[model samples]
Structures are given as C-alpha cells and as structure tokens.
Target chain A: MGDARRALALVRKDLLTERRSKAAFNAMAFFAAMVLFIFSFALGPDAPGMAAGSGQTLLQYLWPGLLWVAIFFTGILALSRSFQVEMESGGMEALRLYPGDKKAIYAGKLAANLIILGAMELILIPVSAILYNIDLIDKLPALLGVVALGSLGFAAVGTFYAALTANLRARDVMLPVLLFPVLVPVIVAAVKATTLVVRGDLMGELWTWIRILGLIDLVLLTVCTLTFEFAIEE
Target chain B: MNHRAQAAGSDTGRRVVVEAREVSKRYARNWALKAVDLRVEGGELVSLLGPNGSGKSTLLRVLTGVTRPTYGSVELFGAPPKTSNGKRQHLGVLPPQSYLYGELTALENLNFAAVMYGLKSHDDELVEALAHVGLEQAADRQVRTFSSGMRKRLALARATLHDPELVLLDEPYGALDVEGIGWVDAFVGELREAGKTLVIATHEIGRALALCDRAVSLRGGRVVYDGPTSSYEGAVSGATDSVRMEAKR
Candidate 1:
C-alpha cells in the first residue's frame, strides 16, 4: 500500500479499536462534562456577577475560555489514553516493525485523537452554553471552525507528546508536564480566536489567531512526523 | 529490470544482503558496538548470540536502519542504513519487544503492517499469514487479550506478511511456548526455503542452531565469533580461549 492507503488503514484500525472499547471517548466526554459542571458550581447561578467579574459580555466572555479549557483538558485525557490502549495489548512493537511511513502512523493516531477530542467538544459546547447561560446558536459555524482548527493543533502536539511519554517512568504526570508548556501558544491563539467569534467581533482580529493556529498545526505536524521514527524505535 | 539486477537489487541475492563497515554506536559514556564489521549474505540464516547488554539488539537495529551507527555506516540492499521510502519496503523486523498495538485485533495489526509494505494483495495475504502462524481463529481478537505466545505469533504474521527480502528477528522466539517454538521454526524454515535472508538474535543457542546456518557471537561490543552453527561448540571454545588470553594480558 502507498502512504495514503497505509494511513487510512491505521486510522481505521484505531477507530475500530476505540469503537470496541469506548473507554477513551467515554473518559474524555465524562471529564469534559465534569469540568463544565465544576465551573457552573463555582460561578453559581448569578449571571450578572459572572458577567460583571469576567470583563466582556457574558456570551462573549465564558465561551472562549470554557471551550479552550474543555479542549485542553479533554485533549490531555484522550491523548494519554491513545497509546495506553496499544501498550495494553502489546501492539506497538508490531506497528514499529511494519514498513509503512512513520508519518502515516502519526497521522492515523492524530486522526483518532482528533475524532475523540472533537466528540468531547461536541458535548462540551452545549453543556457550557447551559451552564454559563450563553446563547451559542448564532455562532455555531464559528464555534465549529474553532473546534476544527483548535483540535487539529491540539491533536498534532498531543500525539507527539503522548508517544514521547508512552514509555517514560512518570507518564501520567510527565504527559501534562511536557504537553502543557509547549501548548501555551496554541491554546492562547485558539482561545483568543474563539472569543472573537463568540463576541461577533470583526473577522480581522480572528484571522490573526487563526493564522497562528494554522502555523502551529503545520510546524508541529512536520516535526512530529519526522521524529516519530526515533520515538517508536527501541 | 533484468533477472540478475533484480536479484541483486531484490532481497534474494546469494551474496550479503547486509554489510556493516567499521560500525560503532556510542552514547555519552561508553561504546555499544565498537568498529564492528560484519556481513550476512542473502539466503543466509545468521544468529546473533550474546548475553545481556552485549549489543545484539543494537547491531540488529543498525542492520534494519532503525539506529544509525555513530562511527561507521551500514547498508541494506547496497544502500546506506538511513531511513528511505524504499529501503523499508524490502525489510521486515520483529523487535525483541512486542511492538504491536494491543487495542487492535490480530487481523488489524497484520493489515496495518501489510498495507505499509504496499502489499496490494493484503486481504488474502493476511489470512494466509495468520493461518501460517496458527492465528486464524484469533485474528479478530484484540491483541490486549492475547497471551505472550499469541502476541509473538501476531508479530510473526506482521513480519512475514509482505514477504520482505530480509527478515530480522530479535529474540523472535523469546515468548513462544513449546509448540510455539515449533511453529516459529517451521516459519523460519519456510523463509529459508523461499531464499529470504534471516538475522535472528536469541539467547537459546539450540534454537539458533536449529534455525540459523551460521552464528555470530558478540562480547563487550566486539565480534568474538563468526562461523557456521554446526561448529558452534568450536566457536564457543575459541571465544573462551581468547577471553582467557585477554585475562592473562
């Protein structure tokens, strides 16, 4: 098989595995809901107080931060579980022996991660809307665009970091330790862009954030694809 | 391509499929393989026998283009052991560890490996490979649920799926049971019959003796012995005499 076909096979394998277990998706979605719930309880039912204290308008304010937080934390949870499934069944070594492009391996993994995190975002959006009492109906397309771009960036970085941490000693703590620091620029840009969209602000400001996200995605994807051969080898 | 050029370029030459010229691997502290020169010709079943920390796996990695030698260079199919799009196509490696994805089923693992090798006839080949390893029944079962022996079989299936020209088995039979050993032996015999080159690293000297035509021994990152498996005892005795001489020095 060629690169594209090999990559698709890997993607199918990952998705089928997840479809069988459902553990990864469930854990991420559950964590996203819990985070939203925690924010709701912490802020209480006082809409005016939340609106006043958070600065900008309520709908414009909470949406970006909430979406980012959900994506970030959910991304961490999902990515950590990414190779854990492979390790559990002793399948990683088999994958390394295969003659496919290492980039295809990363792509397949990133695709799976994107799907899981995307599903988490789907759940988190409406939950955040209900919890923060913000009307997100008009901003659906923008929210989705943010989700796509943001998740792409997150998945790119997250997949590489997850592979790095897979065989490390303190993987649980080390994953976030390594991942969060590198992801600061990505999260900042995504959250900022998301805020602009939420507020119905000028597209001009949002384009800058989008560009930053796109750059982040491209750089991380290239670096990860090239370096995965080193990561997977013994 | 003509038959001779194809045979030379192909993984089926009677001459060496792999050649390492003054290959050395070093970290910050010590050298793992020190200026090692070796070759395993096509259709040669060579066993790498060594104790722990003896650089058996490192040498195999260099041969498979997984790890680059620090000092010198090695070649697979007359090309340098660097990651190339085509070099990997002709090589199959079964790492000492089970490098499969446990979340996937045996069939999925085989399918993934087959596709990566650009095996167009993957579906039929996967089925045949699984059956060859006695894994046809467990093909669809998640690898996480597999026993060590089962995982090894799945790995073997993956390695042989594409019918690579050169097969590198690093402790391939480490996890196999009694019957599993027979299965692996049979598989190796089949590969030899097909005229594919084999480089196996194993602690079990008897198994190596049964499968490999020659055995290469390494000690403290150096080649101490290189000869036929039938003369393994003579080789070990010579290795002991050399070590004794080194002690006297």
Candidate 2:
C-alpha cells in the first residue's frame, strides 16, 4: 500500500511536469503528424493514390500497418522522455536514495508512458484516418481495444529498456536500438490485431490476435517488473 | 509510531545507526573510496571533511546503497543497507542535486514528496513545511525560477519532511547565501537539540567544525584524522604535512 502511494505520487509528478512543459508531447505530436503527411504524399505523388485491385487505395489497405508503424516510432519519444526527465533532473539518484521497492518507480514510469502514448494515439488515429480516407467510426470500439492492448505491451517493454539505457551517453540513439528488438513480438502481435480490426475480422480471428496480445502483455509486464531493479541499478 | 522514546537499537550498547566495514568502491580503474570503515552512533553529529576527490560523497552513497561497494559491507540499524523499506523508512538523504523537478511548483514538489514518503495528505503541513523554510510566499512558484538558496532550503525541507532517525547530507551548503547558510546552521542546531543523528559531508570546514562534535577528515580516499573538532585543525595539518614530507623524501 505504501508502494502504491509512491507510485501514484510519481505518476502525478510526471504527468504534471509534462503537462506544464509539453516537451515530449509537442515533439511526438509534430513527428506523428509529419509521418502521416509524408506517407500520404508518397502514396499519392503522381497518381490519385496507390490503387489496389479492389476499390481500396494503398494507404487504406496498409492503414493499420502504417498507423502502428507511426505509433511505434513516435511512441519512442514519450517512452524515452519518461526516464529522461529523471536523468536531466538528477532524480535517478534521488529515486534510488528513497527506500522503497524501486519497482514502484518502474510501475509509475510505465503508467505515465502509457498515458502519454495513449494521448498521442487519440490525436494520431483521427488524423491518419482523415488523411488515408478510412472510416474508423464503425470500428472505433474494437480498434481502440486492440490499440490499448498493443500499446500496453509496447510500453511495458519500452519503459524497462528506457531505464536500462538511461545512463548511457548515447541514450537517444541507444533507446530505439535496444527497444525495437525486444519489441518485435509485441509489435507483431499488435500490428496483426490492428490489421484484423481495420480491414475486417471476417474469418473470426480477431479474438485470437487479441488473446496473443494480452498474453504478450502479461509476459512483458511480469518480466519488466521483476527485473526492473537491475535495469535502474547504478 | 513515536520513535523518540524507542530504543535506538538492541545491539552495540550505543546503538550503531550507520556502519561500514572495509568498504571500497572503484569506478573503472580509479578507486573513489578505498577500504573505508566508519561507524556513526545514534544522536551523534559527525562532519565528513574532505577535498574535491577525497570520496566523502562516495562514502555517503555507499551507506545509502545508491551504489554498492566493490568490496566490504554496510549496515544501517543492524541490517544490510539493501534490506527492506521498513528499515529505510528511518533514513533521509540530501545529495548535491536538488532532486526536484524544475517544472513543478514548490508546493507540488513537497506534496509529491510527502505522498512518496507515505505521509497522509495534509495540505497545511506542506504549507507549514514551506513556511518553515521561508518559502511560503514562493509555494506556487516553479522551482526552476527559484534562486540556488531557495532551492537548497526547499531541498532541506524535502529531505527531513519524513522526520527520519538518520540524515545524510552531501554538500548541503554548496549554493546557499550567507542568510541561507545561517538558516542551515540554525536548522542543524535544532536537529541536534532534538537528538537526531546527522552525517554532513562538506568542504566548509569552519562552519562544520563549529556545528559538529567530531570531525572525520579524509585525504586521497583515506581517513587521515577522526577526533574531536577541538583538535581537528592542528592534528589534521600535522598528519598530512608529515605524509607530504615522506612523499618528498
């Protein structure tokens, strides 16, 4: 229970700081919007758009993959910035100095990253849907569920790796380098589920993908929490 | 919950609060702390005096378990420093950094720290803590906008907000103004009056020697002199000068 209070305090502190500064959010917003714009321009450069055999354009057919791709890429900023706050403010040593489970720190950081990534997706999804001419209104509920699951899996690992590489001199480059590899299974599960949700679950396999994503999240969350002390150790 | 009346510890008749035996820490090839041994008893105010690379901060870090010793052991309240949070709940630390978020308001910072320390939500208590540090007017101001002295005062409040049995302060007077230094002096005087054990690491030899009873001076990661402050000045100089003369020989 004491650990719970500590975790909640961290979440409040981190979110309040980000809300005031907008450092991570602004950068993520700009980069996410740019990714969507560049991909749209590339798909429709000379022709009307990348046309598939059916009435679908390449942007529509590949919307799920492109959206998750943007999310994963842009999500890196929020995840790394979470721990970067501690690094810049010298709070890492302070965090270690405090006598607690230290896992509380991991949980707090993971929660904050999840919230930041969620907020970004809230904006990115609509913008991408408008740019790509995909109707997400009908699929919003299932799509959101899948998005949440995928993001949980992604953030769980991303937060852990962020702490692991926090003290490195080349952290910005090293964050993605270390994060993306371990995230392969998570990314694959998420993209697959999002793809099923967007195009159609005509074969009734959306649940299978969702189950896989949930399982992956469970595994990642456990491993990350258990070994977190080592990741943040001096 | 009232530890003022509780026994310091059941072991070591005097209740050894902080103990380190043969602790050595190396960063890469350079040893920052070489085979250091120290024992701080309950209610004893000790000054850890040293030069730039003399390892005062390193020893404090080892005692707090911020970094582990490559060799040797450390105990706080008769248990390993890496023990449970229940044991650590009695400890407080103020390192050189403010350990504060610049974007957060002073009040918000204290509130966050209070919750992290597992204290109940008491708005008046936080404001009172701020007021105690002469920061009541700046409660809503962002910490980044604060002067170095203001930040130090706030950090001091944050460190002792939980009212721990042992406090470790590294360079606590580093960025304070004259008035701020006086504030710290008064604060430490009050802590001593209340029988709190404090280990302060600093280069302000004059002020520290005045406030503390014993001085433990370090040179080149070794304890050169550990004795009463009355004899520290002459004894430390004579010892180091002889070592310097031997090196010249």
Candidate 3:
C-alpha cells in the first residue's frame, strides 16, 4: 500500500510538473504535426497506390505505418522528458533516497509517460486522420484499443531505457538507439494491429494482432518493472 | 586508523543506529573514501568535518546507501542496507541540492514527500511542518521563486516530514546567508534537543564544532580526528590554522 501511494504521488508530481512547464509536450506536439505534414506532402497528396491498384492513395494505404512512425519518433521526446525532468532538477538521487520499493518509482514514471503519450495520441489521431483522408469515427473504438496496447508496450520499454541512459552524456542520441532495437517486437505488434484498424482486416486478423500486442506489452512491462531499480541506481 | 568512541553524556547507553565498518568508496580510479569506521548511536549528534573532496559527502552517501562502498560495509539497525530497507522509513537525508521542483508550491512539495514516505497526507500537518521551517507563509508560492536559503529550509522540512529517527544532512548550512545559517543552526539545535540521531557532513567548522556532541574529521577519505567535541574544542583553540592543520602529522 505504501508503495502504491508513492507511485501515485510520483504520477501526480510528474504530471503537475509537466503541465506547468509544457516543455516536452509542446515540442512533441509540434514535432508530431511536422512529421505528419512532411509525410503527407512527400507521399504527394494521395496519388494512386503505387504497388496496389486498390483505388487508394499511397498515403491512405500507408497511414497506419506512417502514424506509428511519427508516434515512435515523437514519442521518444515524451519518454526522454520523463527522466530528464529528474536530472534537470537534480531530483533523481533525492528520489532514490525515499524509502519504499524502488519499483514504485518505475511504476510512477511509467504511468506519467503513458498519460502524456495518451494525450499526444488523442490529438495526433484526429490530426493525422484528417491529413490522410481516412475515416476513424467508426474505427475509433477498435483503434483506441490498439493504440492503448501499443502505447503501453512503447512506454514500458521507453521508461526503462530512459532511466538506463538518464545519466549518459549522450542520452539524447542514446535513448532512441537503445530503445528502438529492444522495441522491435513491440513496434511490429503495435503497427500490425494499428494497420488492421486503419485498413479493414480482410483476413479478420485484428484480434490476433491485438493479442500479440497485448502479450508484448505484458512481457515488456514485467521485465521493465522488475529491472527498473538497477537502471535508476547510481 | 578507525576510531570508535563510546559517546558520553546523555548519548551513553543508547543503541547504535548507524555503523560503518572500514567503509571505502572508489569512483573509477579515484579512491574517494578509504578504510574508515564510525558508529553513531541513537540521540547522538556527530559532525563529519572535511575539506572539499575529502569524502564527507561520499561517506554520507555510502551511509545512506545512496551509493555503495567499494569495500567494507554500512549497516543500519544491525543489518545491511538491502535487508534494512524497511528501517529507512525512520531515516531522512538532505542532499546538497534542493530537489524541490521549482514549479510546485511549498505545500505541494511537502505533500509529495508525505505520500512518498508513505505517511498520511494531512494538509494541516503539512502546513505545520512548513511553519516549523518558517515557510508557512510561502506555502502556496512556487519554489522556483524562492531564494537559495528558502529552498534549503523547504528541503529541511521535506526531509523531516516523516519524523525520521536518523537524519543525515550534507552541508546543511552551505550556500545560506547569515540569517539562513542561523535558521539552520536553530533547526539543527532543535533536532539535537529532540534527541534525533544526526550525521551532518559540512565545512561549517565553527557551527559543527559548537553543535555536535562528537567530531569525526576526514582527510583524504580517512578519519583523521574522532573524539568528543570538547576535546576537539581544545585542539581548535590551540595554535592551529585550521582543523585540517591540527590533523596533519
């Protein structure tokens, strides 16, 4: 119970800090919008599908993958920001001094990252959908489920690696380098599930993809939670 | 050589609360702390005096298990830090830097600490803790707007909010103005009066000598002087430029 309270306190503290500063959020939001805009422009305004003559533009066909790419890239900012705040304020050591299960710190950080990523995704989905000319109103329910699972998986590894590299001098470059490889399985699972949500699952494989994503999230979350203490230690 | 003092006065007969046996800490190629041993009993006030880079902060960090010793051991309540994790509920540490978020209000910072320490969050009590540090008036103001002294005072409040039995304050009086230094002095005196076991690592030689029951001076990461403050007072009053000078052969 104490650990739980500590975790909740951490979440509250992190969110309040982020809300007041808006440093990470603003940068991530702008970057996500720019990624979408650049991709939409590069894909050349919905030209006929190059590889598939299914009467869909290249952007429409690739919307799901492109969206996740943007998310993962911009999402790195949110994940890195999670631990950056601690470093900037010189609070990490002070945080470790607090008595309780160190796992609570991991849990708290993971929760805060999820909330921030969730908010970004909320705005992101609508903006990207309008840009890609895809209808998500009907797909919103299913899409949300896929996004949530993918985000959990993403944030799980993200929070872990963020802490692992928090002390590094080259953390800005290292976060993605270390995170992306470990996140391969999660990325594959998340993108597949999201693709099915965006484009109709003709083979009815959405559940299969969702299940894989869920399992990956579970494993990543477990491993990250258990090993978090080591990463955050001096 | 390690010095073990059976502290006299009221601290006598108290159980040992902190024990560091031949503790040595190495950072890469640098030996920040050499073989050093010290025991702090309950209700005892011990001052760890050292020059810069003499391993005072490193020793405090090792004692608190914030950093591990490269050699030897540190125990709290007669167990290693890992097994004694539960005992840390009664331990409080104030690091050199104020960890208070500049964006958060004073009350909110205390509230965060209360929740982290697993203490019940009572607004009235939180305010009282702030008031104890003369910060109740600044309770709602953002800490970023605070002066260094104000931040240090708030850090003190946050540290003791859990009513910890063993409080380790690193440089408690550093970076403070005269008034702020006096405030810290008053606060430390109160902690001593309340019989709280304390290990303060600082360069405030005079203040430390006056308030501490025992003095353990460190040089080159080794205990150069470990004795009661009364005897050390005589050494200081002698023809010595500084405590470190007397510590020399």
Give the lDDT of residue B5 in candidate 3: 40
lDDT of 2 by residue, B70-172 (tens): 9999998888877845677788888898989999999999998888777885888999999998999999999999998998889999988999899998998
Across residues B8-57, which tens digit of lDDT does each residue of candidate 1 receive?
Answer: 23343366778888889986687788777777787788899878877899
Residue B11, model 3, lDDT: 51
Which sequence of candidate numbers ranks them by lDDT, best first? Answer: 3, 2, 1
The lDDT, on a scale of 0 to 1, for candidate 2 is 0.87
Residue lDDT tens for model 3, B1-249:
223343322355679899898899999898888888888899889999878998999999999888999999999878888678788889988889998888899999999989888889689999999999999999999999999999999999998998899999999988999999998999999998888999999999889989998888777787766788777755433323443463473
Docking outcome class, model 2: medium
The per-model DockQ list reads: 0.47, 0.72, 0.77
lDDT of 3 at B165: 94
Model 3: what is its DockQ?
A: 0.77
Alpha-carbon interface RMSD for all candidates, in angstroms: 3.1, 1.2, 0.9
lDDT of 3: 0.88
TM-score for the first chain of model 3?
0.97
Off by over 4 Å in 1: A47-60, A84-97, A164-167, A202-204, A215-234, B1-13, B27-30, B244-249
